[model samples]
Target: MLRSKKGYATALLASSVFLGACASTSGLDGINDATINGSHAQAQGAMGAGAGAVTGAVIGNQMGSSKAGAAIGALVGGAAGYMRGRSLDIKAAQSVAYDARQAGYQAEVNTAVMQNPQTNQSQQVFTGYRVLIPASEIRNQDPEATRILQKTAELAIQADTEVVASGPANLRDSVLTMLNLPAGQAQYVPSNDTKVAVSVMPRRG
Candidate 1:
């Protein structure tokens, strides 16, 4: 009887230790971010760690030895965490960009493409620029937002005409107009994901 009690205690201790480690590491996995970003790809979660921990614990407890269960559980949990994290990160970036575009900024979504530079062999190239333009300048162009929109449309058309096709002036214009600056209102692009608004404390009436 005493031996059985001791074994139970040991199993409980081991499980607790494993769970504690999981909690600590899971935070770093960035699962929450991946889910929010909508870019997480769950590769091992479904079959690996998600199921492993539970199975590992149950089997280990019944068998009065947690080593087997803990190992399997760790493996499964790790994979799930990784996939979940990645997905959220992707989703977050997309969401931010999509909102900006809908509000009248010409937003673009693209990834690196491979093309040859000198040799015929393909080479990877980075795309997209995080540009910053003052809102005051945008407002001065045309309060109507027409000139900018038409310009962007034209740029896009021109790019399509090109064989390799990469025209960003229109894209730049769209972003500039999205600020919707009034007489004195101005904005600065602090980062790719954020914009800053600046205005004179005095009104020019």
Candidate 2:
């Protein structure tokens, strides 16, 4: 009986420490900053711990071991909460990157959804960018043109979009190769002229 009492006390002490740690790590100021910046993992972890404690306490009470139950629950819940929060952060970053690219390019970013014709079900296709690069720019090695193309590629990666280039056959082919895109995935426009236009489309699996 004495050993049981000691175990219960130990469990309660551990639970208190865990709760205290969470509170200190995720204070109100921290949470507010994370929410404003779209980085909520820390806040989510704290919230998860609190929620887990309550749930654990209830379950433990039913089982006559509330403290131990609460401690274990908090650990598990905190991990799951962090993952959910990280996912949200990634989505927010993608959105910001897409918007910035659109504004800088002064071109509308095109989005399309592809559907399975047989099943009549729709799947979201690649969010992509379409831009026209002049043939002269490529020939003269214009730094601004190069920067724009490079930035476009970077943004596509950040936003998880695909690239489509249509212009001088040679330029289009070179860009496609530089992107390491599969030949089968690229759609090239046939032109004997110097003007080149490229549109980055999302890769389909």
Candidate 3:
């Protein structure tokens, strides 16, 4: 215990002498503690600004300023427009046209018209397409399958009749089934026929 006390007292005496020597230094002694802290803060700020400038330059190079921005904007905008063009209504018109041909009819598409389902809002007007089919194709088939195909065709037609577009399910399925209809001049009879629904083959993901 005595030795520990002696050691601590000697350390304090040495620190006091060191401080006293520093107190006699020239202009450094005139500077205050706040000045030292302020100097360190200024150095940190300068380093931060330099780093920020480099990052900004890199970003500018990649994205450009105006012209490059316009190009990128146009590309994205075009892709969005194409996707919108393939919306259900537009596709339904093509579907009906294609499906009619699949059913062995000479089909032609007429421009389609679309309307707003609400409050007679007409501004959403867009042209729809139509298919002109021959009546002979419906003449002979199992009544059940014939009815399904006819119903689907009608649904596809009705969907585009005014404005609202129907989903592809009806037309797609019917087209596939019509393409596969057995070739014969047989009349439809419900008891022997199955009410099988035709489906549109989906695109591979």
Candidate 4:
């Protein structure tokens, strides 16, 4: 029975990896499309399995069946890791929103939790805020508008969140394109998914 359980757990992990890979290829299949910066499912699964195995072994030894304990531990650990990943996503989003608010933008922020079809797990997702800057203000190239955006980006960096400005079709495209480019690079693609236009800066440790 213990051996059977162990095998089942192993199979589950393998299945999870396969599913996650499949999900990654589909834009809408994984956790909230807007919140995924990169794939972390495999890493999270491995870590969970390792931690669970060790913990289960320890407990099983006490109960005269380390193998059984390990299988149970693996399941628990995997779930925990998935939850942690989701929480981190939310925290990062919230931090960015807060920073934007402090910079005087009327920031709209919200949290979401969803299941990832690939990993068969639930994750926390944060939809980044939309800063309500008027179309007229943006078109005028208002200095104050520029300052607000600049400060928001700086604050986002400090808070470890990416800033994606969404508003006014023409102005939004222009500003996001400028912000998304590298310091010397001038290429910018206009996007309907404005949430992804974060001016990513190197994270400070």
Give lDDT: candidate 3, residue 156.
39
lDDT per residue for candidate 1 within 8-96, as digits (tens), equals: 46545543442233211111111112113121333423444556667667766676656655654555455444334332333333443
For residues 27-137, write the lDDT of model 2, one tens digit per residue: 011111112243355666678778877876776666667786577557655644543444344333344334434434333344333332212333222244455556777
- How well does model 4 score by local distance difference test? 0.49
lDDT of 3 by residue, 80-174 (tens): 22223323333344454455456554333332222221112222111333332222223334453364355334433333232111223324333
Q: Which stretches of candidate 2 lie over 4 Å from their true place?
A: 1-106, 112-126, 172-189
lDDT of each: 0.35, 0.49, 0.32, 0.49
Compare candidates 1 and 4 on TM-score and give the better one: 4
Please give the RMSD to the true structure for each candidate, in Å.
Answer: 17.1, 15.1, 33.0, 9.3
Per-residue lDDT of candidate 4, residues 1-205 (tens digit): 5665665566466545532432221111122223334323335656876897788778767767777778766765665554455445444445544555555555554434544433556555433334555545556766655655664454443334545444445665657543443343222334454232333321222
Where is model 2 poorest over a 10-residue stretch in terms of lDDT?
24-33
Error of 1 at 40 (Å): 8.8
Best-to-worst order by TM-score is 4, 2, 1, 3
Q: What RMSD value applies to candidate 1?
A: 17.1
Per-residue error for 115 in candidate 4, Å, reads 11
Ranking by lDDT: 2, 4, 1, 3
